[model samples]
Target chain A: MINLLFLPLVIPLATAVACLLAWKNQGLQRIISLIGSFLLLIAAAVLLVTVQQDGVLSVQGGGWAAPFGITLVADLFSALMVCVAAGMGLVVAIYSLADTEAEYERLGYHPLMQVLMLGVCGSFLTGDIFNLYVWFETMLIASFVLLAMGGKRAQMEGAIKYVVLNLIASALFLAAVGILYGVAGTLNMADLARMLRESESSGPIPVIAILFFIAFGIKAAVFPLFFWLPASYHTAPMAVTTIFSALLTKVGVYALIRIFTLVFFAELAAWQPYVLAIAGLTMVIGVLGAVAQDEMRRLLSFHIVSQIGYLIMGLGLLTPLALGGAIYFMVHVIAAKSALFLATGMVLRLTGTTELKKLGGLYRHQPLLAGLFLVAALALAGIPPLSGFWAKLALIWSGLESGNHYLVVAVALLVSLLTLFSMTKIWAAAFWKGAVVNGATDTPLPLSRRVYWQMAVPTALLTATTVLIGLWPEPLYALCMDAARQLLVPDAYIFAVLGVQP
Target chain B: MSSIILSTTIRLLLPLLLLFSVFLLLRGHNEPGGGFVGGLVAAAAISLYALAEGVAAAHRILIVNPRQLIASGLLVALSSGVIPLMTGRPFQSGLWLPYSLPVLGHVGTPLLFDLGVYLLVAGMALLIVLSLMEEE
Candidate 1:
């Protein structure tokens, strides 16, 4: 069972190699990618179940002992993250069959996508901070290439912004790691937690903590660091964008949660107010940015930033309920946001544009697509009986329970309302309004029925996942609560990784 | 660069550089030289050849696609890791043979892994350099 912990990392890597081996045959690459994704999903599910049963499963790379060698640990939180990431990988792989062009596939898209999965799953599962940095680099390189694959003028512009900002983040992250090693003398997360808790020296720890915050903050795309996201995300192909929406920022949030809970537990209280302030501003600014956008994808991209604020809010509250709510919110938002992006991709395909002024009457022409978009949109807006509503409810409930956070709670509520308004803004302009008489709008792209099903099915599956989670939030919430508990009490994690009683 | 002097120097230098890179790969286990540095040297050799000759000539000399080399190298590295798994050890645990070779010390999975890295680095570098050169 412990061996299964690394399967999430290994399977995607093997699949990427297989894809690369079959590079010339796009058809073969697609088939191999799909199969690989399915296997990964299964492996992730098994790993999640193993973690549920075993408490925390860790494996040392090359049979090295903990704190001395690289460790891959799968606690409930990492397991849940890996599971969701794998599911998204499979869904996007399926979606790519219809959405990705032959030219893109020929440019090594399939292998790069698997490599991206490998990096994501590796980041989630690694028990070492330096290992996490390596995975982040792997993910960054793959995403940079995927972003710039076509080398279109816009793509080049977007990729340049994306890479420059991300490289800065990577540099800061590495610098922080180096300083941290100088301070703590170890890169193992479990060991660091133990040392930080036991140490009397408070010097430079706070600075290191802040540096980490900034590094991950940029990746998470919080306030004042999110310019690259909207500038770049809308420029990528939709399949690439869909996976990025599901994974990239979430990985940053995951890293923040992991490092803060496990290593910086002593400093979280001191940082709470500032974290809350940042959270509130991120929510307001992101939604306002969305409200100002007329393009479909750019608006959704802004919403990704807004939703990240809520995740930070949960972390700020620092209560188990708040953290659990954040975890549940992460799962909900990935499904909801990916569904929205996939549906928008379909819109882009049918209308040859995602511009609101040029896109109209989708409700009349492709009612199914409109309905798919509406389900995901409503979920994003926190409507009843959808995943987002339950996520928000849990977060808000946790906020109210954690006293003296009323202002941010009010901000959260207002953000939800604004989210709804902007979602409807897309609906009113792109779907409910009359179709424009422009030449591009008049001639919808001719999509084959098979390709249409390929695209629609993945979007539907993701939407269904959101609806299912909303309708039956109990199991997931319970698991998330368990994860939150484990995160708050780091002794179990430390014991699992370092075999030491803290 | 169609300089006769540069091309003649590259022709004489290429075989020696390739041999030196292999030596580096083999000595990497206990020495400063390793797969990464070795691969870089080898890539420099090939890239210099491309500069002296042309990318088309370099491609003809390479025979196999750099992309294929990358894939095969990754496979080799992955298999090195998996070899330990078959023996029920953790992934990437080094497994050595009973006897040592002439120049290469105790033959092991780590060496095979290094070889894979060597091939992959060389392929990746060549791919980048060749493409950029082609664009020009």
Candidate 2:
């Protein structure tokens, strides 16, 4: 049963290879990639179901026992994350059928996308911390190539900034990993957590945690570490940008949540205040940055940074309810944010530009498209009966229950207002206003209905999922509660992976 | 790049480097010479061929694209992981044949996994190097 964990990673990787083999035939590449993603979706769903039934599941690599050889472990949190990522993979694969250019298809875009999914699934499943780093590198390289595949000037510029900063973060991560292994004598996460708890003097553990913070912080795009995100995210192709926006920083956030809860839970008392401060600042700065942006993608990119702050805020609160809220919020953002990006891509396709000044009359021209955008936009801004509302409300309620930081509640509410403001700004500039009467480039023809359906279908599906979750938050919330329980008290995870008491 | 002595030396050394790379790959499971090092050695051989005979000649000898090598290698590695699952074992658990092979002896999934890694590393390195060399 534990072997089932490998299916998610293996399926994508094999499918990536299949896609590459069929590189000359773009249609075959698409078909193979789609099959691979579909298989992965099934695998992730099975893994989630198995974990729920069997409790935390772990597999020892090469038949080696825990703490000696590599291990792949999955609890509720990892399983749910894998499922969401695979779902995103399936959605993006469908979207790419219409959105990816033929040139990109020939240049191995399908394979790279699959490989990116491989990295994501691998990262979510690996129990060994070092293996996680390898997965991060895998995701990084694939994304780097995808980002600059078109060789546009803006893309090259963005790719360079993205790669350089990430490389720095990688170096820091490796150094920290080295030191951590030195201290713990093991690289398996469960082992490290057990050892850290047993060790009498944790004087150096905080320093190491800070290293991980910076490493993951940069990747998560929190506050001061977020500069590279806005610069690079807007320049990729629609499919590439959408996946990167949905998955990349979220992986970083996952790492943060995992490391903090499992390995660093005992030390949270020292770190909680700092984390809360960082959370507040990240939200405020990210939304303000979004408010200043004119380009549709850049604005959304900055919003990613702000949303990350909320996830971290859940961590800062150090309560099960708060963490559950964070998990729920993560699910909501993944669906809503991707929907927003895809909707923007559709608008760009119709108008031939994503610049707010150049885009208008979307409401007049395409009411369906405008409505889809509003669904995602309203959800993002925490409107009632949308996914974001529940996510925000949960976090606020937990913050109030904690009764430590009244300011955090205030900042979060204020950020919601600002989020609405920015969404309104996009709505006004791109939808409500009439298209500016510029010359020849002003009025590009809309795509054929069939092609429009190709794009609209995925966007519509994502929006529906968002609204569905908002209306019936019971199932998702229950899952988050279980995941949060597993995270808060990681004895189940450790026992599953190591088969021993701490 | 234009030096005759250097080109001739590389041409002479290429076969030896490739042979040694294979040897390293075979011995990698229990020793220092694993798939990663072997792949680097193999890539170095390919790089030498590119330097000596030029990128076109290297491509001609390569026959299949390096990308195909990478993709095939990944599939092979993935298969090694899946092979264990056939026995109802956990993923990535080593699966061994009941009898010993004549030369390599006791062939197992771990070695196959390493072989996959070897091809992937060599292919990835050559892909990047050859692409750059061709551009130049």
Candidate 3:
């Protein structure tokens, strides 16, 4: 069980080395990544089942006990995240297979992708804050490669900002870890939580908490800190943008959820309300940015920021129901967001453009594509019987239960309306127009089997997961409850780290 | 003639600069030196050579692109803390070697992590320098 925890991380990292060493062999690289991702998918499933049975699993390194050595632990939350990351990675692999990876051996996109996935999975499951920082830096390096692979004018320009901003964020994350390490004298989350629980009035506690909050805030694309995302995401290749849209910032949100629940729980009374305010404003501002965008990808980028506010809203509320909603919605958003980006990728491939002005009547011409896109879009807008809707209801119900009804209701209403407005623009400009497509007006080439298969499989799988989970959320709900419990207990994690059963 | 002298100076000084960078990285964790400082020193060495040679020529001599190096170095560094997962411990629980081979009885993942940091900083710092030099 313990070794399995490392598979999702190790396989990808190992595969990356192979890919680099075999850089000349594109087919080999593709096969290795596909197989490697599939193996991780299997590992994630195994982890899910184990967590369901045992609740939280911990592994100690070099035979050293907790607080003295590095530890990797998985609760239901981490396991669930591992599944999401591996599943999405598999889909992304299939998406990349249609293109040739051989022509650019020097850039090593294939290898970088593997390493990036390793970092994401590691961050999701790690119990140590310093370890998380290491993973964050790991992920950032791979991102630099993936972003700059094209080396075109736009890519180079965007990579400059992307690398610089991420570097600063990494530095801040390191600083937070240093501060936490210095104060806590231990990097283990469970121990820190226990310490924090014991020492409520400690002066540096809130300071360290605030530092972590802002560091993760930058990663999560909170309202004021989100300027870097929209500027750079639109510049990358559609495929790269799609994967980034799905995974990158969500990792930030994931960290926020992890740390707030674990190390900073005491700050809830004083600081959480402020978080709620930021959450509300982030939703409003993010959607407004989306509404103002004309480019399809840019529009979607802004929506990512907006949807993140919804996840943060749940955290701000700090109730089980709200957190559950947040978890469910994160899954929904991951599915819907990635699907929307891929659908856009298909549209771009078909039409060679992403500007909405140059795109119209896609629904009539490509009904299948339009259908998939609409499903994802509507799900994103929180329509009922969809994943987004269930997540919202849970959050709203939880918020209402806590006497924060007005805040929850108002924010939900405003954010959903704005979400609908932005989505409707997509519906109108891209799908609803009366058959006047600009790029291929006279003779549109039929969609290729490879392209259709490349996108359709992942889209169908995600859509089904969203719907199924929304309709019958018992399993995921139970999983999240268990995860939240593990996060709150702090003792289970601590005992696991220290090699003691107390 | 002046150009020849400049190129000769670059040729003579690059090795010394690189060696000094190693010294900084080796002494980093304990004695006021570390990865970031060492990385900058290495970048200075590379930039000096890049100035004498054309950007394209320097790129060939450097071999790997800085972006890829940054990515791989990061991966290396990240794996340092993460290897504990396989051993059933926390992500970065110090897997120490207790190396007492002829006086060096102190070693752990953090040192390896520092090495990763050194490589990443070197690659990242050089990437910027290379980009600017290319533009020039």
lDDT of 1 by residue, A103-180 (tens): 898899999999999999999999999999999999999999999999999999999999999999999999999999
How well is each residue in A228-268 modelled by candidate 2, as lDDT tens digits?
A: 99999999999889999899999999999999888877676
TM-score of chain A of 3: 0.96
The better candidate by lDDT, 2 or 3, is: 2
- What CAPRI-style quality would you assign to candidate 3? incorrect
- Give, for candidate 1 chain A, the lowest lDDT window spanning 10 residues: A435-444
Which is the winner by TM-score between candidate 1 and candidate 3?
1
How does candidate 1 score on lDDT? 0.93
lDDT of 3 at A222: 90
lDDT of 1 at A499: 85
* Best of the candidates, TM-score: 1
TM-score of 1: 0.97
Computed on C-alpha atoms, the DockQ of candidate 2 is 0.71
Clashes of each: 0, 0, 19
Give stretches of model 2 more than 4 Å off. Answer: A439-442, B1-17, B46-54
